[model samples]
Target: MSPGLTADDFDFHLPPELIAQHPPARRSDSRLLDAGSPPALIDRGFRDLPGLLRAGDLVVFNDTRVIPARLWGFKAAGEAGAALGGAVEVLVERVRADNRVWAHVRASKSPKPG
Candidate 1:
């Protein structure tokens, strides 16, 4: 580990072949590891999820789905060159209370607040 990092900086090594490239045959067939007291071993189906939780337990989920917001276009007659136009990336962080968005974008330069 580097001087600035501790155990938290450690990560496991996984080969590409070890990664799950596709969803399981059935969602319920996915793996789960119980790390709490009396650690139990169980293979459960995704459909069995509701039964595992007690009623009224608050659940938080990331409802944000993917968006194809990438834009690739050249600024005509601009000082910036074609190489700058090739640099394109866009990332939407979150939707704000006022319906505006927080985002991270990349190109040849930064963007001003809207």
Candidate 2:
């Protein structure tokens, strides 16, 4: 079996503007950032992925169920009808109460409750 990684060792920070809030022109047009254990990070495009991989390679996936907690809410601009729409992605960390939940939100800008 492989060695286990510590929880703290896997911490990563992603800028809000860099988040995928909007769909790309093409799925393959997305940019890929290499955050692996290399001395320097190499920025590459998705088109290069197919050429880099060879046969007989195995990829492992997490068995955890993914809950689509994607939410589209409008930010409270001056008035009600003039509000702007924004994408907010929330990852449930824990449940505090029946309606209260601890979560991490990623957005292009600060998201406000409608």
Candidate 3:
């Protein structure tokens, strides 16, 4: 790791409108940002990736299968689960061997620990 490097170095302001809510109609139609060389940013298509590679170049592949792990529920306001505090969205990132999970949660109000 480089000395004095911090997580804040990777933080930036990405406007929410720039975020893609849905995938392209075709998988290969996705946009690719070429930042291999600094000070120059090239916009290319996914199909253009093949010609850019040379022999003996290392390629990393993410083969993790996607699953429907997102859950939608409401925060409980009462013990009997009769009242809804607010809507909650949970994206389960990983399941552990100890029957626990790591997730990204979004809600109007943060849930308190039980």
Which candidate tops lDDT? 3
| Model 1 local distance difference test score | 0.62
Q: Write the per-residue lDDT of candidate 3 for residues 1-114, one digit (tens) a residue.
A: 768979998799989998889999999999898888988989899899998899998989999999788999877775666677778899999989998999999988897764
Tens digit per residue, CA lDDT, model 1, 1-114: 647877865676869996778888877787554323345656555576676677887768898777765545433333544443334466667768998877667767654433
Where's the lowest-lDDT run of ten residues in candidate 2?
70-79
Which candidate should be chosen as best, given TM-score against the real structure?
Answer: 3
User: How many clashes in each structure?
Assistant: 2, 0, 0
What's the TM-score of every candidate structure? Answer: 0.48, 0.43, 0.61
Clashing pairs in 2: none
> Please, what are the lDDT tens digits per residue for candidate 2 over residues 1-114?
988899987789989987888878998998877655487788888787766567986767588875665545544554556665555667777667687877888878867665
Q: List RMSD in Å for every model shown.
A: 6.3, 10.4, 5.0
Sort order, TM-score high to low: 3, 1, 2
Candidate 1 vs candidate 3: which has greater lDDT?
3
